[model samples]
Target: MNTRGFYDELADRYDLMYADWDASTTRQGRALDALLTTSLGPGPHTVLDDACGIGTQAVGLARLGHRVTGTDLSPRAAARAAREAAARDLALPVAAADMRALPFADASFDAVVCADNALPHLLTAEDVRAALAETRRVLRPGGLLLLSTRPYTALRRIRPTSEAPHVHNGPDGRTITFQLWHWHPDGERYDVELFQLLPSGGTWTTHTSGATYWALPEEETARYLREAGFGEPVLHLPAATGFHQPVLGARRPVPHTRSTL
Candidate 1:
């Protein structure tokens, strides 16, 4: 399946990927908020979760008092995000939008977050640049951009074919999730098959979804950020940031004003 179709199909089951969705949201939010605060300052700042799926980060950030807006490429996922936020009584405005072309005025937000390895789905350098340019355009001068992605450095080296499964037991039953990776010969792109084994009456049912990604490591992503007009980008690993994935941060540089003639 394509990216949108894959996410759309997985929207309802997305939470199943997490052992405890609610707790994951809170933990991720705390880490992201701390990272942002340390990089920028304390905020109730206007923020955008550009690739928000089922309101994970957006809802958590909103709960922590930031004014957050969420957008996703999948309409179903966006709708699910909105509903999830509403269910928690949080005000998160969500819409279906492509990251390469956001529907907002220029310099509209204090920060933009494209987390959870979303950018690699672009699959090509040109597409990645377009999205980064759009993200930079939406940020006010000196505004922050937070991006999280898988550890592509080692993946490029080892080329693991499959990920370890995560099994979760809830009140209803048990579910197991894992991924299979098929790398292209070029060594920079791969197709992912996400498999979820769900409990059924007397039997287990398997559901599968697929998408492609480019193996974009920190150095390459930072280069794209700079090319798209952001300031020098910094990489934060999970060990240092307490985040689940590697996070990169960059800022839009403030323009210099000329002295009076």
Candidate 2:
């Protein structure tokens, strides 16, 4: 099965499934806000929400007065995010696009954000670097790139049989499903199979999909960021700030000009 297609199919119900994860969301948002305040100073402005699933954080940013452009790999997710933005009476440009090849031009944005362990979706360190490069390419000189991801060690602690329940409203009806998963460790990689149960009449259809991604070390992540032309990353625990610890903040390097010889 196409894992990407599964996410697209699950987009409508995405918010409902994770609404109860409020504590986690609040923490992450607060951390992000802190970084924004410290790095770029206060103010609402244009920002890109890369891999914005269902627009939860994007909506929050819009509500905070930032003009947000949210992008997702799934068209269904983009549609849902756009609908949410509309419901809030906010104009958010939600586009269906790949992170590696962002459509925006260079120096087009003031900041770029990728939250909720979204980096892992790329499945490789090179993909993460490409995404970061695209982010750097689009952000103005000295602009910020804020991203959060679960540490490699954290994934090891997650129980194999864990399942999270999510609900979504669709044209057909309310679709409620459980995101059940079993984590299988392979060296530094985690093979994750996610199961969803869809209620059809009285019967529930079980759909299984999976993806594999490297659990990269923080040192490796920092190296990639530096290689991609980002400044050093600052680590902070999500529990401390109500978000992922060490919200990586990097600045786009400003090019130097040679004096007349």
Candidate 3:
């Protein structure tokens, strides 16, 4: 499946990927809010979640009082995010959009968040650069940009075939989520088959989705951030940030103004 199809198929069940979806959202929100505050230092900044899949980060950030707007390639996912936000009495406007070409004005936001291993979905250096360029264009001068992805450095070495299954026991009994990876010969890209199995009477119901991703290491992503006109690109490991994945933080540089003689 393609990117949009993968997410669209998984929209309603996306939260099932988390053992405790609500708790995970809150925890992730807190961690990300702290990161944003530490970097920007203020209240209620305008933020854009460029790859907001079902509002995983956007909803949490919105709850923290940031004015957040979200966009996703999957219309169903974006719609689900809006519904999720509304259910919480939060105003999180979301649209279906591609990160490579955001549907917003220039300098439209104070911060842009591309979390949850989203950027790697581009699968090519040029595509990644285009997305970053769009991210930079939408941010105000010195606007913060944060992105998260798996630790590709280690994964590239190990090239694991599958991920450990995540088990969640809820009102509906038990559900298991896991992924099987098929790496390309290049070692830099892979196709993922995401599977979720749920209890159904005596049998189990299985749902699967697929997508391709480039194993974008922090060093490579940081280089793209710089080449896209962002400055001070820094990688924050999960050990330091308490986040699940490595977070890369950068800022759109303030354009230098020439003084008249």
Q: Give the whole-model CA lDDT for all candidates, comma-separated.
A: 0.93, 0.72, 0.91
lDDT of 2 by residue, 144-181 (tens): 88877766565555544544566655444555656444
Native-structure RMSD, model 2: 3.8
Candidate rank order under lDDT: 1, 3, 2
Ranking by TM-score: 1, 3, 2
Flag regions of model 1 displaced more than 4 Å.
Answer: none
- Tens digits of per-residue lDDT for model 1 on 1-261? 899999999999999988999888898888889987887789888999999989889988998999999999999999999998888999999889999999999999999999998999998788999999999999999999999999998889999999999877777698999999999999999999999999998688999989999998789889999999999999898999888999999999999999997
Clashes of 1: 0
lDDT of 3 by residue, 1-261 (tens): 899999999999998888888778778887789889998997688999998889988889999999999999999999999999999999999999999999999999999999999998997788998999999999999899999999998899999999999988878788999999999999999999999999998679999889999997778888888888899788888888888999999998888999999
User: Which stretches in model 3 have alpha-carbon errors above 4 Å?
Assistant: none
Better of 1 and 3 by lDDT: 1
Compared to the true structure, candidate 1 yields what TM-score? 0.98
Per-model TM-score, in order, reads 0.98, 0.82, 0.98
